[model samples]
Target: MGRSPCCCHDAGVKKGPWTEEEDKALVEHIQKRGGHVGSWRGLPKAAGLNRCGKSCRLRWTNYLRPDIKRGNFSDDEERLIIALHAGLGNKWATIATHLEGRTDNEIKNYWNTHIRKKLLRMGVDPVTHQQLPPDHHLDGASASLLPEALLWAAAAARLGGLDTGALRQAQLLQHLLHTIGSNNDATNLIANLAAANSVLNSSSRIVPSHLLQDQMNMLSGTNYLQPGYLCNTTSNFTEQDVVQQQLIKDMSPGTSTFEAAGPADQHCNTTAAFAARDVAPAVDMLPVQEFAGLMEPMELQLPNLCSLESDSFWKDLLEDGYRL
Candidate 1:
């Protein structure tokens, strides 16, 4: 037998947005009952609201609740959304639990209307949170350089014992770089890059890996580094060129260098470097500032290259930056 509906369809119940009078009635009813309305199904009749139980509940939770915060989301909230989304996927209700006074509907709407578009504009796949495919409009060298830069940043992060936040920031920067590289949009790109660079520069402390891993595990409900999760060398540069030119410059002089290889090959090298080096002291660490300095040369060169609009400019930048 089919189950009966919760409310009769022919009850002449009101629907859609609640009126101010309706809000007052609902508020008064709740207040009169000492703020306990009991089951929503019975409360509508008791409160003299000609509305469905579901609609009444939604209105109360989303709008009428005294604790509900209605305003633009702060930067902390935005970052929390991204981090939570990365870990929790599309569990909007679950994500809302971490954010006080924010409803799932509001979170979902904000993500769709604002954050999703921003990530897409930055050349990140909103679904996967990974870099998007190279745009066909990009010059060949430009297309390749962004991916190489990302791979390099990942490598540097792993080598430096940087926090997961640093790694996540690198991923975001990679998205921006990919967008600029593919679309050839230097105007907005430069401004965004400057802002990102400033943020990275202001934070000079090296976060301990174990503490970072613990926090990430707690937030994500998983191990920080699953088996076989290291980043691969995705650049198109030859092995010889990558190894010879891109030696860990920040490491103390006279330390042995390993030829950079695919993720699998480099895992042993990374492990060995960590095991041998005492990175407890901040001086021994490769700061993100040094990495940003490496990118400074590119900033200086972007204006001239962007003005040229020639493939040769991209080719020269890529070749010089990567020492290819």
Candidate 2:
């Protein structure tokens, strides 16, 4: 049950949270008067409010003000507040002048309740807006307990209830995006990992040689070879298909890392194409089948990562700054 309201005291002044009636009286008085500035002292008496001049001023300036913004702070607003706070050093009233419709008290309360805790969790000194010393920040926490990209992945994983393996992959994917920085090749690589869940789900599906090639390309396209398109094939299972099957069969996660010669094509004698590219740093170096056809990015069936009642699940997550 709710606690009894802190009604008007012996002095006839109300305390605690202001009520609807009080707020209305304060707002109406300010609207009817030219405005409440130096007039704050007289506002309570004229407006039929039992609040003190200070209370009336605070109510009009901080809470009942017509221009005050309400609701959760936006990301831009939060960033701006942080930036302003860094320079102003707890001069919340000064900070209030810069932020549209936000009062000094509200900003101060938000800083105490929310942003300060988040910064501490991330090992940042909220007061200085700088990375805290390793010895001081949250006891044993690192200089940066939460790097932005990794933090985003971790947050998404925890909130979405992703398994440990998937969470690892998400972190790995974020790192790859930063490291590789290639166009279609890098994109295909990530799509491959995202699609791995599907392949893993259907372990008994008897994956086709071509499909295995797709996965291999996804896993390590540059270091490992990808099957080129079949040209003028004679057998139901072409030479390209047979070779790929044998390659997949021979290479497994247990296979030791080793470099292989490039292609054996008519253009550069297939085996003469550049084998010099660095092998992908995947721990499991599954060797790819070296094909004679032109090396092209395999068409992959990218999985629908997540689906929700509304727009695509991934799309919604991204829009919500889950990518942050």
Candidate 3:
């Protein structure tokens, strides 16, 4: 491993951190010596300071700079800092953009001291979107204790068991579109979403509606609509049929609405419900031919008698299928 650095590395150089005397000297030197604010690497040499350029620059910018804002932080500023951190995460540079006159270090320190505790008190897990354990305490915990990415997984579980693969593909396509600054990549995203169970079963699958609405909601940008070709096909299905199937599924927990909705939503619950409500049922209920078009064709395969042997014979014959 490499050795650690020390402020006293060089002999005959003013070592250690910048002091009040050194700060005054540097300030006076800059005021009296009228010259350009040279590159950071050359500032120490120009200012007659023995410190490294990085150290000198930091001391000047963070502590001695004229534009530096110092004093107690305000409550509104503190709340803004918390919101920025929650939304954008550990990007101090980006967070600093929202905070006027606040350095990254100062915001970082304030987060560590005050806002972090406030988040804990609000039953909000600062990192994950879950509740923190009541008995467990945070003494030596860092911000990493709450990783934000886990929120995606939690949200995925809530949003009808979203497929991780589909979500990732949708995200990548969105990012690609954003990078190229166009909507051409939207086709692939729509195809992926239409193939998923979530969109096919949603009430919004009705006409002219974007198939990738869910994905767009997740990504926060990119209004990737399903292609007009796909939407045109979906127009064959009506909104009321989709709603009824969803209501049925919501009423019946065990079954999927896909079977009830059929290939087109217009064919199922809407037509059936309407006909049953409007026309009188014959004393003899109508035969299957009345609804033959609405039903899926069933496969009829007769089992061979040879395949239906005694349980004892099959048990012995299928013994190899069992494992230890």
Best by TM-score: 1
* Index of the highest-lDDT prediction: 1
RMSD in angstroms, candidate 2?
A: 20.9
Q: Candidate 3 lDDT, tens digit per residue, 44-86?
A: 6677778776777667766776656889876446644553454
Minimum summed lDDT over a 10-residue window in model 1 is located at: 227-236
Candidate 1 — which pairs collide?
A: none
lDDT of 2 by residue, 146-261 (tens): 22223333335443544544433343333223222211233344443334323333342222345445544544523211221111011122223322233334344343332332
Cα lDDT tens digits for candidate 1, 1-324? 876567637468887778999999988888888878798888788888888888888888888887889999865467556645654457788668667789999999999998888766655555545455556132233222222233333334433544445444443343333222322113222333444455443454222334333333332431212211111111122122222123233345555432322344345343323212321113333433433543454344433323312333223222322222
Better of 2 and 3 by lDDT: 2
For each candidate, what TM-score against the reference? 0.44, 0.40, 0.39
Clash pairs, model 2 backbone? 263-270, 263-271, 264-269, 264-270, 264-271, 265-269, 265-270
Candidates by TM-score, descending order: 1, 2, 3
For candidate 3, the 10 contiguous residues with the lowest summed lDDT are 293-302
